[model samples]
Target: MKRLLTAALLTLSIAAPNAFAGDTRLELPLQDLIDSPQAKEAGIDGSVRFYLSGQAHPAVVSRMGEDVSNKKTNGVGKSDVESCRWVALSVLKAFQESAKARGANAVVDITSYFKKNEFKSPTNYECYAGNIMSGVALKGTYAKVK
Candidate 1:
């Protein structure tokens, strides 16, 4: 009976998960880097292009940022990376919307800041203790890469 009750409790725990996260939409200045005219000329009207830090680009139009944190209470035995990936995706979506609105062809110099990313921060242990993962802060420069 004890084992059955324990199993039922575990099942209940796995059924419900909770987390606290946030989203930020930013308006960056990428006018000179890839203006509408320039973007149109370069055929860079969409968000398909991306350039990381080391990649070369014509110019920097603006800077954009988005931060997201995710947690899974039921994910005690699950993969943290997987849980964090969802948060990353949320950040990416935010980035995409802002970039598209600003007519940016790509996001450059993208960086990731995760919760529990390093031992120096309390989030690392807090995430483990609370069965929560947080902070997928992604910031980047918006530019035309064509």
Candidate 2:
């Protein structure tokens, strides 16, 4: 009976909803922001292109399989790299919106930040780990060539 109760409790815990369960919508420039008479008067009718990039330090530990030290382990886990990717995507979306707001047709010269750092768990576990930071940056000016 105890085993059954434990199983039931575990199931309930796993099924519980997360505090932040919904996917966030990407922020982009609205047509109204760029299609204003003021924007047209300001010579914002041209296309503007930009690029963005950034990086972040490793902030999580991922362990896979019985041999955490084995580099060839088939375990999959989260890392700072994943976080950076998300950040980059967000930045790119923002840039796109900004360009649109300025009446730019598109962006160019995009790049991303990249690096590797050593990481150790805070719990003082003598485990092997790596850190990575990623970034996105934009370069280009808005012009009214259109």
Candidate 3:
């Protein structure tokens, strides 16, 4: 019986190697997520503004440090875009709080830092959607801007 079960499992693995792989790459507009009402709900009221990669910002007064946020996916029955935005909101909120804590007024040079890979886009962000979850990762430089 054990041998038969092992043989069946082996066959299944061979038949569908990608059955459990769920990686959907999406690049969605960045401004929409930043402007969403949920940002207010997250307490990100523009006190600590964000500037995406290649976007212009006021002269940086001081560089506090780098910031990163890797939010877990909470996507169930939601579209990839919706799920991505929600996770991105949470990430940005954290950044805002961090900037505030460190006396920084902005986070600039934001980019997608998924899997430690940097994906920079001036107008969009990259998200990975899976079967049961989606994730948004961000990296930025904390700064006190003019």
The lDDT leader among the candidates is: 3
- How does model 3 fare in lDDT? 0.86
Give the CA lDDT, 0 to 100, for residue 145 in model 2. Answer: 28
Q: Please, what are the lDDT tens digits per residue for candidate 3 over residues 19-84?
A: 323378899887887788877887779898999989988999899999789996667788988888
Order of candidates by TM-score, top first? 3, 1, 2
Q: TM-score for all predictions? A: 0.44, 0.29, 0.84
Each prediction's number of clashing residue pairs: 5, 19, 0
Winner on TM-score (1 vs 3): 3
List residue ranges in candidate 1 displaced over 4 A. 1-46, 56-77, 114-130
**Model 3 off-target regions past 4 Å?**
1-22
Q: Which residue pairs in candidate 3 collide?
A: none
Residue 115, candidate 3: C-alpha displacement in angstroms:
0.4
* Candidate 3 backbone clash number: 0
At residue 100, what lDDT does model 2 achieve?
A: 67
Model 3: ten consecutive residues of lowest lDDT: 14-23
Ranking by lDDT: 3, 1, 2
Candidate 1 lDDT over 67-105, as tens digits, reads 233323333454554444334445545656667777766
**Candidate number with greatest TM-score:** 3
